[model samples]
Target chain A: MSARTYLDAGGRAPLHPRARQAFDAATDEGWADPRRLHAEGRRARLLLDGARESLAGALGCRTEEVHLSAHHTASLHAAVLAISRGRRRIGARVVVSAVERSAVLAAARFVADETPAGRRTAGLPDGVDTVGVDRWGRVDLDRWQEAVSRRGVALAALQHANGEVGTLQPLGEAYGHARAAGVPLVVDAGASVGHVPVQDTWDALAADPADWGGPAGVAVLAVRSRVRAVRAWPEDEDPWFPGGVSVPAALAAAAALQAVLADRERADPDRRALVDLVRSSVARTVPDVEVVGHADDRLPHIVTFSCLYVDGEALLTELDRRGYAVGSGSACTSGTLEPSHVLGAMGTLTHGNVRLVLPRGTVRDDVERFLHDLPEAVAEVRRMIGATGL
Target chain B: MVDARGLACPLPVIRLAAAARAATPGTVVTVWWTDPAARHDVPAWARMRSHTLVGTCPLEQPADRTGPSGPQAWATTVVVEGPPAAPPD
Candidate 1:
């Protein structure tokens, strides 16, 4: 018999071979601080610059625009703070979609929570304006336009695609409104960059290395030349700021991005078909299961659904015991024991949520095995809850 | 009274539903549960069964219930009126 299928790419993907090689090579030769004036430092600096330039090529931005950071969450918080601070003189309102990543939403809320109502807080945006999303988790474009058009808007945030449901947002419309308002648009491409084509129009973009099979602990924050984004932490205090990016992780990330982009065209359709199969099969086999997100327009490798009678945590545990690894954006899994904000915003069933993200090189057989095991797992969870009949 | 504590998710609601069905008319069924989902699921179940939600409050550890390490902790106490308007089909 073949090996048990591993279907939990949404949690963290297996590292790509090229990324592994690059990271291994970098640790030996590129460990020296790039800011030092020694020969070893020069060698590390060269590797770091090369990685930045390579990532710049992939992202359609200049190497100088890319600032490597610790991770996606930190990068997003820094970017939001910097961009909002840079435009503080113009306004103090930062706007974001309701379905944005928790990092983005939290950053906005942090700033809003710190200050008094209608009062400008130094180094922080005053008020946060949230734009609602449609039932499919797409930002309501009309509401977004209205919020971004407000005279006191300092910055606006919209993700290229939602991480939980895989729904792609209308970034172009959000960007157009931001441009008209003379505000910088920050796009979190953490979920879409390596899997799909990310446009060059957004004023600022954030991406994580783990999204493309690279190692964790590093992310890229790229800002357009025309956009003014000041670093929340100065280089003197934070050595890893601006040009002090981790050489090894950055190099590995660049290699991984190149590898994924090279074979994306060939692998996209195959992976997408597997995802579609899961979406259809789950709905077909699992009673009262609601598949969330756009039917046609979504990330090629991600599918999410909510089972009505199952407990999210129990169902996750059952799948794990059956040798299938999956993740949930549900409240029970989120440590808060509340429903998924993405599902809640869409007015969809938030309980028993399951998200499946296929990693690169996933075969149809593996996906098929997962599909075969899922209904049984759901049924087992329901039975445990004394909900066997339903 | 149903002590559904230490159980996760739909179990609490299922037990509550059963208790609500078994209780006589005008009697109140109090369900002590640990799972947070009961905050919403229990209320929804009551409304669906056409029972009145007497109230819901934070529950403290029961005086008689002691754990091996210490006293047990359960967070939610959901109260519902008994005798469903319609059969629990």
Candidate 2:
């Protein structure tokens, strides 16, 4: 266990120490239903409101604009569906980057398919429009403009950064186009909220607690008051999220965000350097490997690469045997029949993929050791599948 | 012709490369690949091996529909460019 290296903290991190402490305390003070008029409920509500304010301060939004959801995907689903419903008088067309998370894409498609059958075009799908991306996994701004500016377009959603490839999108430019079209833009900053400076360029934003070394039960969603978004679910006392979120989880998430923000300026650059080291070493030492995503315009702590003539699962297993934990976006390993939409949309090789997300405070020596073992692991995986000497 | 349909990932390209290795230069190696990775990996493998990815065309089912792992076939053709195989005659 002492020798093991974990680089696969994709959307979840080990709970921050401060977060653990906060969660333990909140478990006691924040356990009430938070809806009753009783004193216990008032205490829970206070804790919940305080957490919301903390997240809002970190996100650069108003406290009222920030709300908590059960998890990250729920926040995105509500953002997509409610925005579509709110703008129902307008056409149902929703524009999303090709590299958006599967949850976002699925929700977009759901609302698109919900459009009246007669309203749909003969060949084209009416509800959603997908904009293609470049080989670097960055969205094509010109194409995005064309899509968003189309008549009757309801809303647009683009992730701040792709978790799989670590490529940061041109959110400033993309958001500008959406604004000019009078279309609200939703930014899924789940991958960038804690690791990078999220621009205030979004009309609505979704963040993941798991992404910030917090407890996984709560997620943050901030919607600008003018996004024309209504609750997607049935009318309830709590419109955004019907059932209240766990107070303890919300408090833990808040504490973790504050702790991460305080240390990020000092810790992020070191993580960036370690990632750069792995990028250079892997490309230099390994043969037929492609280091993917934008070279400079990317998340600091994430690096992804694809190896030719190697199976993604086999390579992952080989690395696991060496006590190195990594991630794969390849279809065989992704648990989905299709490979990563991010890598596929970028026209990159999707097999033999490895995604390394360095958690905060990852030691440099651990990364170096992993780099030392990576080449041999890839070579051995290739050889096992009768792919050697070709 | 090699049928790598239902095989995931590097298997498709690996099989293609293995097939190309036995043929003389300019011999065409055809493969039916279902794994979506072949769309990029086969071309990538061809370029890395100095082989020619001559033709590619989508077959029966388009790969975009997400669900269980099954054959989502696409026919790909690569022409060999390396030296001839060892003769046993």
Tens digits of per-residue lDDT, candidate 1, A131-225, equal 89887899999999888887777789999998889999988878998898788899999999898899876998998888879888789889888
Best by TM-score: 2
Best-fitting candidate, scored by lDDT = 2
- Give the 10-residue window scoring lowest on summed lDDT in candidate 2 chain A: A118-127
Compute each candidate's TM-score over C-alphas: 0.82, 0.92
* lDDT of candidate 2 over A71-144, digit per residue (tens): 89999999988987788777888999999999999999998878877656433335688999998999999999
What count of clashes does model 2 give? Answer: 1
Which residue pairs clash in candidate 1? A331-A338
State in Å the error of residue B28, model 1. 18
DockQ of 2: 0.53
Instruction: State which docking tier applies to candidate 1.
Output: incorrect
Query: lDDT for each of the candidates?
Result: 0.80, 0.87
Model 1 accuracy (lDDT, Cα): 0.80
Colliding residue pairs in candidate 2:
A112-A127
- Superposition error at A105 for model 2 (Å): 0.6
Interface RMSD of 1: 3.6
